[model samples]
Target: MVSVTENTEQKIIDAACKVFIQKGMDGARMQEIADEADINKALLHYYFRSKSKLFDRVFVEIFSDIVKLLGEEINHSTEIIELIERMVNNYIHLIRERPFVPDFVLHELNRHPQLIVQQIHQYGMDFSKFQLLIDEGVLNNKIHYIQPVHLIVNVLSMCIFPFVAKPIIMGFMLNGDEAKYNQFIDERAGHVVSFIKSSLLINNPE
Candidate 1:
């Protein structure tokens, strides 16, 4: 059986996520969140104390999940290509299920970049594994000598931009066909992997 606090905390978090997604941090109202949670504002305060505190918890939880999937763990694996492919596939699958997450994060990051940086440091993440992978690939002649950060940024940009721009892409480009829009997003993972492989593959020696 779930504890009362656990149940109420989840309800508050869920309600806050929706409210933040809809109104953004600046525009979100405490009363609106309380109403959405079906609880009074006093209870909301008893649980979270302040809107900023609640927002921090929500953002940290969501951001930590994304960082774990996209940043920290992927770099720790030796099979860099396989890791990238898996991360892309998993991330696309998750975004398909929770499409609002990316936009919500971006909105908050725009409002407070330091929060993200602080959370990343707090999690003790280092990209050294990714750097080592790049070094190994270069030494083995499997990839050209380029900065790993650039490669990572490119890969992440390719994977994330479509989702970020989904509204405009679906409206203007796909004529608002939800099926076509989803299909396009579903195809992006494979397309991104293929592009990376093509860029990284070694040339045959004569």
Candidate 2:
């Protein structure tokens, strides 16, 4: 069970995320967030100090969290196929858990792309580990030679495009059946992994 303080904090964060995405940093107001969260402005200020601090928290969360998730999931893989599988599954689930995240990051990004670069620097994001895994796959003759960026883009595009285009996909493709839409999303990770592996693994000499 979530504690009251933790719940309140999360409420604040969620409200702030919505407001920031809807209004951008320039238009979002602390009182509006407080109203949305159903908390007084003083309490919101007590938790976040200022609108700059609140926006910073929400920005880091919506943007930096994915970078962190990718690092953790990719770093833990036992093999190249597992790495690809994990990336697809993990990212799809992340989007499922927080559908607004992609829109929030993309919409807010045009205003503050610099903040993303700062988060990357702050996190010391080392793709070298993931790169090393891919390099080993090539060296061991397990998977076809491919650039990390290509694979990264592949995984991200397959995982994120659905969420970015959710309304159209859910409306037209799924015909507004949310359950069917979720099922399609549920099946996507496996299909993506299979598609990638089929393209790459067929070249293996084994």
Candidate 3:
């Protein structure tokens, strides 16, 4: 049996997510969140003392999930290609289930860039695990000796930027055909992998 407090807390969190996505952090109102949760403002306050606190909770949760999905574990794993494949697939599924999450996260990130680095440190996330992978690739002459951060940024940009820029791409590039937009996103996953592989795989010079 769930306690009333637990249930109410969850309702508040859910409502906060919706309101944050729709109105952004600055624009969202406690009253709007309360109405969305179908609860009174006092109850909302009881669960979350302030809007900033509530937004921090949501931001941390969302940021942690994204980092976990894209962190060193995936970069350091022996089966990195397989890990990348699974991540792409899983991310796509998650996007399908929560289409608003990407836009919401990006909006918050634009509003508060430092929050991302702060959250990364708070989560104890470091990309050093990729150091070995990068070193091995360069040693074997498989890839250029570029900083791992650059590689990470490249891969993440390739994976996430399409979704982030979907509206512009669809509106101008694809003329706003919903199906075509989806197809473009679907193709991006494989294209990202292919691009990474091509960039990393070595060719013997004569």
Candidate 4:
């Protein structure tokens, strides 16, 4: 039950997203997006006043999608190790598919950090539950004592740093071979999970 107007708007948004992901804001052209959407540039401009406006729309949705994704996945579960594994794997897969989202988001975030605060307020994000889970794990001797913030930072760094530094990583480590770099990213997910587990889990001597 989609109206033609809404459908056309969505088509424009979809085409814009692809172009933005490929070339980012500076390089994305309205005519290119129009061609991709099979619409005329004039019609595209009618829907979105300018490329910046289109980019803003796409960027905001990307942020919202990421926020929703994190909110959905970070539900507190008893199986902390499994959760870590899932988190790492999910992020790597997502970044691999997009390949441009990580750097693009960070670049935009540097320009508009307040946008994140605004969305946080809008979403009423809750970290208290996850904090409680970490506290319980420490008390139960399930993992080494660590602050929730530190643990979160560590996990995110492991999951995100490689993707953020993809060009350098690929250039230096994989010798600019995209397939090799992709394989490295894929394998790094499991390695990160195991690395976190090893660091957090305490061994009791017999």
Among all candidates shown, the one with the greatest TM-score: 1
* Evaluation by lDDT, superior candidate among 1 and 2: 2
Model 2, C-alpha of 98: deviation from truth (Å): 0.6
In order of appearance, the predictions have TM-scores of 0.88, 0.82, 0.83, 0.87
Regions more than 4 Å wrong, model 4 = 1-6, 204-206
Ranked by TM-score from best down, the candidates are 1, 4, 3, 2
lDDT of 2 by residue, 1-206 (tens): 12355578898998888888777788888889999889998999888888888998889877777888888886688687888888888899878877867877877777677777788787886778768988888888777878888888888898899888988999998889999888988889888988888877747333
lDDT of 3 by residue, 16-116 (tens): 88788777899899999999788899987787888889998877776677677666446547544454566666676556566777888988888888778
- Superposition error at 202 for model 2 (Å): 2.9
- The TM-score measured for candidate 1 stands at 0.88
RMSD value for candidate 1: 3.2
lDDT of each: 0.80, 0.82, 0.74, 0.78
For candidate 4, give the lDDT. Answer: 0.78
lDDT of 1 by residue, 126-189 (tens): 7777788778878887777768788778877887778889889999999999899988987889
lDDT of 4 by residue, 88-206 (tens): 78887877777678888887778767657767786776767567777777888888877777877788888888988988988988899999987888689888988888888887432
Better of 1 and 3 by lDDT: 1
lDDT of 1 at 153: 82
